[model samples]
Target: MGAPLSAWPWENLGIFKYMLYGPFVGRVMYEIFYEEEKDWKFSWCLQLLILSAVRGLVYLFWNCYTNSLFLTRNRQILKQGVDFKQIDKEWDWDNFLILQTIFASMAYYMFPFLQNLPTWNSKGVIAALIFHVGISEPLYYWVHKKFHGDYLFTNYHSLHHSSPVPQSLTAGHGTVLEHMFLSLVIGIPILGASLMGYGSISMIYGYILIFDFLRSLGHCNVEFIPHNLFETFPFMRYIMYTPTYHTLHHTEKDCNFCLFMPLFDALGNTLSSKSWELHKSYSAGNDSRVPEFVFLAHIVDITSAMHGQCCLRTFASLPFRTRFFLIPFFPFAVIGVSAMWLWSKTFLFSFYYLRDRLHQTWVVPRCGFMYFLPFATEGINKHIEQAILTADKIGVKVISLAALNKNESLNGGGKLFVDKHPNLRVRVVHGNTLTAAVILDEIPKDATEVFLTGATSKLGRAIALYLCQKKVKVLMLTLSTERFEKVQKEAPLEYQSYLVQVTKYQAAQHCKTWIVGKWITPREQNWAPRGTHFHQFVVPPIFAFRRDCTYGDLAAMRLPKDVEGLGCCEYTMDRGVVHACHAGGIVHMLEGWTHHEVGAIDVDRIDVVWKAAMKHDLRPLSSGSTIKAN
Candidate 1:
């Protein structure tokens, strides 16, 4: 169904809709700049904006808190995770607050009674509560029941119901008309008290804060309220609704439409018979689902750190790009980094399902630059070790180390952990075997000679050995001839001649097939022939500087279509695709391999892992295609 006429005019503006507050902001600015004395109305407007900001932070805190696996374990009401559709649908959850601000501004101009309100009125609190309980509750109940009727249900109410598994934002998600009704239901209590000379700034703030608190509590999808509380004081159930109570309204629809009170639903005979039972079940902490697979990841940079699913769902769903709005938060990000460095440990990042198995991603609180800092290696390894131990204790089947977490220098690509805990049942995987495989699969089969950069590195060494065995001449690029000879000797004597050491880019000027395992400058890239394709396995992938040559993405694979609940992208990869190492870990889990894939890449298992990946329908994204960079 199309959006109703009551939809917000600036709904399509997305995050930029906050700019609507500009005029109110300008009013306060003008009063401060030009006038020695400010109008009370203008000052109140500023207070409203500040209050809205604080309320927004409250919602954000709840969102992150509920999503924290450790804190909310077994307390989650819905098993299903939010998808990109729900994220986009609820992106403008603060629109209602903005609308309320606009309404308050209009009412001040229209009614002279609202001016010069006192800072606090104890009687106003009593009046506001009475008005809310006696008037707003019943009015909202009837309006909600009516909206479920044929015309309104189809055209308006369905948008809110679209999210069966709700978050805090879901409480504010509805049609503009729906919010208009909500504003009146909520506003009348405050305004009525004001007109009767019982309204105060404290009363307004307290009433709205409680209103939002209850609304968010009902929609957060976490069963934090203890069942014993309701059992002890049975009357409290009629007074307040739990998250489980409101979830039934979305899932079971037709029943439990009351706002904040089950008493309304009880009176209307619309309350679900199972509401109490479900609440008890959720509050008892019985539905914990531990993931079988976890991909251990670390932040690549300051900008990449903000691309977390919890930080910004909309931004994380797409390939990452630097947004102008993010610039304002750079100082806060620096503080967060400092905090993480000092006190943070491994935490759950995101999760999804594939073939009835739970797959999670965990993050180590360190940036890419931190990995290179000599002093930070011990700290980073400690976080990783703790994560592995925790996963093992929880009976996790597999945990894959991503990117710099598996650095050869740090822990010999995770060999340190596995060796340190030899009795550990949980399989640790570097997933680099499949990374080498994906990069190798991208090279043309007919090409006899290939120029290799970073030839002495792990994947590079494996690649040189594997290619030489196939009779492909590998011009190994390295300054250290000793390192080149060391990797070359790994191949059979017959293939050793095929792996030749070369120190400079000029050695590959005639070579058309280039396998890049290191970051190369525009000048280094120019050495390859005009028609050459660059296959890479480097971090932050090499820049595509030459328009004449086609550049390949870092090794990655499209996950099988059977996957579900995947809302956010993995760094810069597309929606359903993930880094080859991430996919490799998935394959490791799906194949039920008992071995730990650590240390150097296994040259023999390259084909085996590649074939297993293919068997599971994880297609290589870089194969048979060329990416031309401008």
Candidate 2:
């Protein structure tokens, strides 16, 4: 924009291109006169032409209004960190022109472009609308199928989804060749029907306008469909739409096609059967692989929490020996739970809160007015609980410790303070007040297990160094694979290195993780055991074992695959629990957890806890594995 308008590409051609569409449409209208009604004089034809032009112009203006903020994003804001890459491609006006010409031609000549027959009768208008759907929809559906086949999607349909955040104006702003091809794909059927005295051309105009309006509405960021409509008239769901449904299409979810009706999509197998309930996940690691077996993992981030399908599939697939059916049926095992809960309360008075239905509290959140209510509540609270547990174990005053400055770190007297177990009796200080001596304050008096978020700040680095010098157990938390690499690269190189480093060393080590972005602790791990939402509140389990945890050992692993042991990662730490991204958390369990760490994890100066056994350590409660407090 700093350059003069003369340097701008295509600034001159825009006016010329705009003028070209007028004559092109005009010629098409002139041919339509042959099908004009006898009652419709030249004056009427002129009126129709003017009306169409006005309607098209009005539609275009509406898109302009909605996108008034479009030009603002063009300005650079400071320096760019990560370019979203939505606008990197070069634009070619000529290619767009060619496409427009093709779509317009197919829409006009190949399809029945005139519907003057409807000007004479009332039913003619209604019949014309029905006839348009009967013809074009089927034809478009089949052709669209071709565009989605293997090897075709990346080169073809991908261009349209480049803008994941499609604004209202982005409607139909794709290659014109696509438009022309579709026109022939659609219009020819109408043309054939019209020649057979079965179709009216005016319907074609109505269909295009309706398609554009509804499609644009679907692309809007706001939710137009009232919740009451979806809940009350379930049958009418396919009638109107909610924003969540359409916006997901602009993302990497490849298989969702069909704009007008879901019929083609349903038959095409492109519709995500999991869309309804796929958003209730609470993972701490980055290995979200979207498991093919359950497909439930995909929903964890969405709302796909339903376990019904898994149960059915497991029941059908598992043999008696493998106990695969036991996998999915776990969610439903709570059947006799209430009865036992009542008995325990009435007689033994154990698990009293659970047995007494009136006082029973659920760790899992329940639904309220909105659908995602329970999920949102649980997700928020679960993270917070982890934060609190981590803080408590780190040995700090739960009340005094607060979140740290994102750009900096916090320390507590020669030891990085954490609010892990909640029994601390100390005051928290501002980041500016922190120093190396303040960090090493009081060596936990005489505590055992040490914990640390390794990638904290310089203050954290000082505290960690002091702790290491003292020979206290050092628990390091490393986050974000990219930053992990920066430190890892500068780290004493273990040569045998070539591209980045030129030498070799016999004894060297580097950080095990490689996540993206900064390692966040407080905001991510809600220090509170539970978080409250506008409608509901939630409390998540903190023990390594979970109650009602559907995936057994997977309950501890983030984005865990199935119960199957996929073998060890580079961390040399393979447990059903410690995947590479989350191995830092296993520091607390290091006391007796060596057996579970399948990979050759560096166990130096570590003491992993050992428990989960059928004999003594771990016992099964209805909820999950449990080890009683000493």
Query: Which candidate has the top score in TM-score?
Result: 1
lDDT of 1 by residue, 1-630 (tens): 365555878888976898999998888888778877666454877877877887787787677666765457578888777877788788887888889899988988887877788889999988888899999999999999999999988888888999867888888888888999999998989998998999888888888888888888999999989989999999999999999999989898999999999999999999999999999999999865678899999988888877876666667788878889899878877786677777777867678888889998998989899899999999899999999999999899999999999999999999999999999989999999888888888778787899999899999998888888888899999999789878977899888999999989999999988988888999889889999988888876888898899888899999999887788899888888899999999999999999999999889999899889988999988666321111
Overall local distance difference test of candidate 1: 0.86
Which predicted model would earn the best lDDT?
A: 1
- lDDT per model, in order? 0.86, 0.33
lDDT of 2 by residue, 466-547 (tens): 4444444334345455543453343234411211211111111121111111232333323212321010001121232212
In every candidate, how many clashes are there?
A: 0, 62
lDDT over C-alpha atoms for residue 466 of model 2: 41
